[model samples]
Target: MDFDKIALEPIRLDEAFFHKLPKVDLHVHLDGSLRLETILDLAIKDKIPLGIETIDDLKAILKPGYRHKSLDDYLKGFDITLKVMQTDEALYRTAYELAQDAAMENIEYMEVRYSPILHTRKKLSLAAILESVLAGLRDANKDFGIESGVIVSGIRNISPAISMRLAELSVAFKNRGVVGFDLAGSEYNFPAKDHLKAFNLILSNNVNVTIHAGEAYGPESIHQALHYCGAHRVGHGTRLREDGDLLNYVNDHRIPLEICLSSNVQTGAVADLEEHPFRFYHDLGLRVTLNTDNRTITDTTMTREYLLAYENFDLLPLDILDLVMGGVKSAFIPYEFKRDSIRRTKDKVKKMLVEEAVKQGVTP
Candidate 1:
């Protein structure tokens, strides 16, 4: 498609994109986006020795060119971040700071996912771990005015029965800030069907379900997540581009796909920014949302992700607004909240774009 030849211009960082845009991030991972400085402090607090000490070293750990040979390889970097986040205090602070970071990037709402089961190794019960994360999210909401929802992921490598237990916990903790349930990790070997029992439980309890599929595996994974697991949304459904019928089905069903650009590229899901099917999905009337899958790990933000789309796709303000609205529409929160967010975001974007349009003497 010669995406490299697209006449898209980059939006100035503090100028057009960041200050004026309103963003909704639907697929951010809480554990994957921890701040390096915070990680260092947490490691110090627990006396856990990190091989790389300085911020630069942490950046190298995060951006290791050859380190992430595949999706599994990319996820290995999270081991250190997860290790330092064992305590309640550490979890709370990390979640709270993540919310604050989202706000700073002009994100009105975000759905941050993580596996509480992984954090339970510190003797903290599942409920306790979820509670601590919720507490941080709430505190951040109060402090930064950024609303967020938590999606508890059943690690793909985990046992089906254990995953079912997590789903039970999700259904139990529904209104307590846990918005949905997801299955993640090793997409190829651990198929979504393996976790059908857990998803069935979640479905029986009327919990929202979103699955990570079509990122590594092709359209079959997406099909399983939508048809079998009953996912309302698919995280990183990049491989769906290979299947026209499935892509059409997504649009027909109005299912949202959370597209994480740099993560997909870094993990070798898609080749890079230019080859991303974001524009194709958008043009096909599919509900595609932009996200920073792992903020610190990928060294990105919602603003940067949006800007990347804008520049790489040569998208105008209206296009960016529509993409942002797609995320808001696909959000897991209540309908009323989604409506309000879209309303406010539309007004803000209209006002900003009107100003820019007038300044540039461009017709709206």
Candidate 2:
């Protein structure tokens, strides 16, 4: 399998073929990716009062793929998901189900992230909140052989004091199924620097940090995330193109940008799919990786995200390989483990390319 030769032609694959490729999702939000039926069931079990009688009715309201007026507007759907996710059973179920869903899509690994503070609404202790999700992920790994990790997140609109608490929880769960710490939520008025104290704790303790920036805000938010907060990766860096020097710095430093393409369109980060900076950033040699920010909210999967990149950017098999390698390299797994995963991913992708070439009657 000579991928160098395959790089010469762009491969148009079906969804079924894309499903057979190995994938990673580093930026998926657990609360926003719940299954619709599961949400209804949880609501009934918890007596959460969803106000919808059937799945069709609930589906009409969610309208997962519909375009929103703004990022804030797209976030209203969370209120409904959060309502039913307050109990331990709900957390475990959702976490387990998310892992199952990812596995079905051929995602070999994923980092599920959410704010523990939000799950504490039912007077659930922070440790309980974190543990329940971990337990589900652990069980899923045992059953499906899909490796996973949890990234405890701190919301931006929330106070720094609360972010600090979430950071401490992230530190406490360090190697116990929690891979990293993150700052998520509204990026407009609230800046990443405002959560400096939490980042400081996350840093001093030698934990991985990834922040949501440059989505609602601009390049400055990404700058603050990298410079002030020390993010190893920037989530939804839709606006990093606004600053040239910083863009080069990011490229020079090899910092991975978790690009969520469809989510950007639905959330109004980009006016349309064609306007996404993914092609530009990839052309400029930045380590850009595709992800499903909120699978249900954004109505996407790892396969779908890659397909969009393939069709929209006219990507070849080699380009897909670059994205795959970038994702494995940017994973927060320990050095030796990540190195191994990268190697395995390369082998799997190479084999898949060969299989596809045979099917297409294209000799490499």
Candidate 3:
């Protein structure tokens, strides 16, 4: 019962250990995850005029570290990425490479979310954008054997009417690659409740919903996402700890908190990694899942995120396993698929633990 005493024991985890661990990422952004090399190549090929001719300059401009003055500052990097992602080919390649990148780190299942409306600047239709991204994911699955789904996101900074149209698109692609609807964007002034009509439409059509809340704001934003928008999952619910009663409500209801630690710090959601609420939420038995909200922008991988959690929180291998299982349970996939994936992940983790114990000459 004494968590402090348990936390004192060190658990050694290496890159190979995390690379072999089956994981799930429920909150990765498609446009935010294009490869750096891919971005440069696309920029030159498409003549997108990114202003940065070299990759070093690009990294300096885009790959800001795990701390920022504010969320808006962190979001500035998206402008360059989005500029190049305006075409069907760009969208398809980014989605496919995102899946490939996750699969390299042993992410067996992932749900990629992006605002399709953002990709239409090149005169591509909304349906064309969606299908292009889906096509890339489909091809990646065929090649890498990683199961993937799409979550159509409605940006709060955008119009509510546009959100409604995105909700309709999500419904149309429900059983296809698309699995859920999300409300994501700047979380301070743009409240999730403003987009309630889209959530209502999504819910009415029996679709899943997750909202970005409590990252830049506080518990009130999270409350709106849960109470008004009816989110099944909460993206970066970092401020939920401020409201004990609401935290208990989320815990009791088993709402999964998609905790993107690196992105949280980068967006100034939390002061730093040490101040992050992930350990607090996990210790209190909240359903917390790890994710890379933006791989390219944050310059992170699933393995790196798990490693960061291990190093920052001193989470044992078992704790990391629990988070992985929590992510699988919180995924938008069907119940049957969730069960099978959890089982497979558990078996893999068990085998890895035994191997690690044997290597250390310790009794399992």
* Every model: Cα RMSD to truth: 4.2, 1.0, 2.9
lDDT of 1 by residue, 1-364 (tens): 1212221322233335454488888888888888889998888878887877888887776663332568988988888889888889999999999999999878888888999988976799989999999999999999999999899999888899889889989999998898999999889788889989999999988889999999888999999999999999999899898888888888899998989988898898987777888888888778888999989888888877876776677776557667877888888888887788778877776666555555555532
**TM-score for each prediction?**
0.93, 0.98, 0.96
Write one digit per residue (lDDT tens) for candidate 2, span 262-330.
Answer: 999999999998899999999999999999999988788898998888878988777888898898899
How many clashes does the backbone of model 2 have?
A: 0
TM-score of 2: 0.98
Q: Candidate 2's C-alpha lDDT?
A: 0.90
Q: What's the CA error at residue 92 for candidate 3, in Å?
A: 1.0
Q: Best candidate per lDDT, number?
A: 2
- Note the residue pairs that clash in candidate 3: none
lDDT values for all models: 0.83, 0.90, 0.88
Please rank every candidate by lDDT, starting with the best: 2, 3, 1
Q: Report residue 73 deviation for candidate 2 (angstroms).
A: 0.4
Put the candidates in TM-score order, highest first. Answer: 2, 3, 1
Question: Candidate 2, after superposition: displacement of residue 210 in Å?
Answer: 0.4
